[model samples]
Target: MKVFADLEEFTQAAGTELGPTEWLEIDQQRVNQFADATDDHQWIHVDPQRAADGPFGGAIAHGLLTLSLLPRFMHDLYRVDNVAMAINYGFDKVRFITPVPVGAKLRARSVISKVSALDNAAQATLVTTIEVDGAQKPAAVIESIVRYAS
Candidate 1:
């Protein structure tokens, strides 16, 4: 994990790659829970038996399910010690590049793309590329913003 003493230290590292987070397994239970919560009971994501002969050869995770993991990924990726609080600003861009099949291990490689200092806070934009284990293409690429209050 990368630790920054304060927002200033973090801002100084803008345009630098913060590196990849720890791997997380995408299991059926997680996918099912996400599907139930979102009411997205798509066969490809929930019905494992029927999904066996589907396009990806098995049940795959929903794109949003993968997207929702950003918080956990960021938590494992880095931290700024001097910041009193951090808030998720929003996403500038997001793309689902590849399917994440059940049981696949995923991790995110993050780069601090931009940073701006506000009156009482700092905003950072991170370009996170989530890669699936052994896959040639990333599962998703997202530009996420966060605000840190000192």
Candidate 2:
């Protein structure tokens, strides 16, 4: 993990590549839980047996489920130690580029695209790409914003 001494340090390193996070497995249980939480009982995501003959070949994870993994992936990627708190500002752009099949290993690569100073805080824009292991295309691409308060 890359550690920054403070928000200023992180800001100074804007345009830096923070590298990739460790791979995380997207299994059926996780998919099922996400489905339960969101009440998204779509067969493509929750029914393995029926999904075998469906579009993705087998059960696949919900696009939002993969998108929701951003925070976890970012935590594994880097940290700004001097911040008292951080908030997920929002996403500037998000795209579900490819399907994440059940049991697939996924990881994310992040780049600090921009940083701006706010009142007693710093806002950062990060371009994150989540890739499926052994797949040619990324599962998701997002431009995430975060605010770190002093």
Candidate 3:
């Protein structure tokens, strides 16, 4: 993991490449739970037996479920010290390029694309590319922003 001395150090790292962190499997249990939480009980995501003959050949995770792993992915990448708060400002653009099937291992690589000053904070834009093990295309690409207040 890369550790920055402070906000200035972090903001100066505009072209920094953070990680292709350890992979985490998208298990059926996790997918089912996400489906339950989101009330998206789609057969392709929840019903493993029925999904066996479906398009993906088995149950798959919801796109949002894969997207939601951003926090987990970033936690393994880098950190900045002495920040009082780091708030998720939301995404600028998001694309679900590949379906995440159950039992597939997923990991992410991040780039610190830009950092701009706010009145009481520093806003950073990270380009997070999530990849599925052995897949040609990324599972998702997200441009996420965060505001760091010290």
Candidate 3: give the clashing pairs.
none
Pull out the clashing pairs in model 1: none
Candidate 2 Cα misplacement greater than 4 A, ranges? none
Q: TM-score of every model?
A: 0.97, 0.98, 0.97
What are the per-residue Cα lDDT tens digits for candidate 2 across 1-150? Answer: 899999788778788898688899999999999999999999999989999999889999999999999999999999999889999999999999999999999999999999998888999999999999999999999999999999
Error of 1 at 111 (Å): 0.2
The true-versus-predicted C-alpha distance at residue 147 of model 2, in Å, is 0.3
Q: On residues 6-31, what C-alpha lDDT tens digit does candidate 3 reach at each position? A: 88888798999998899999999999
**Per-residue lDDT tens digits of candidate 1, residues 1-150?**
889998889878788787688789999999999999999999999999999999999999999999999999998889998889999999999999999999999999899999999987899999999999999999999999999999
Q: Which regions of candidate 1 deviate over 4 angstroms? A: none
In model 2, state the lDDT of residue 93: 100
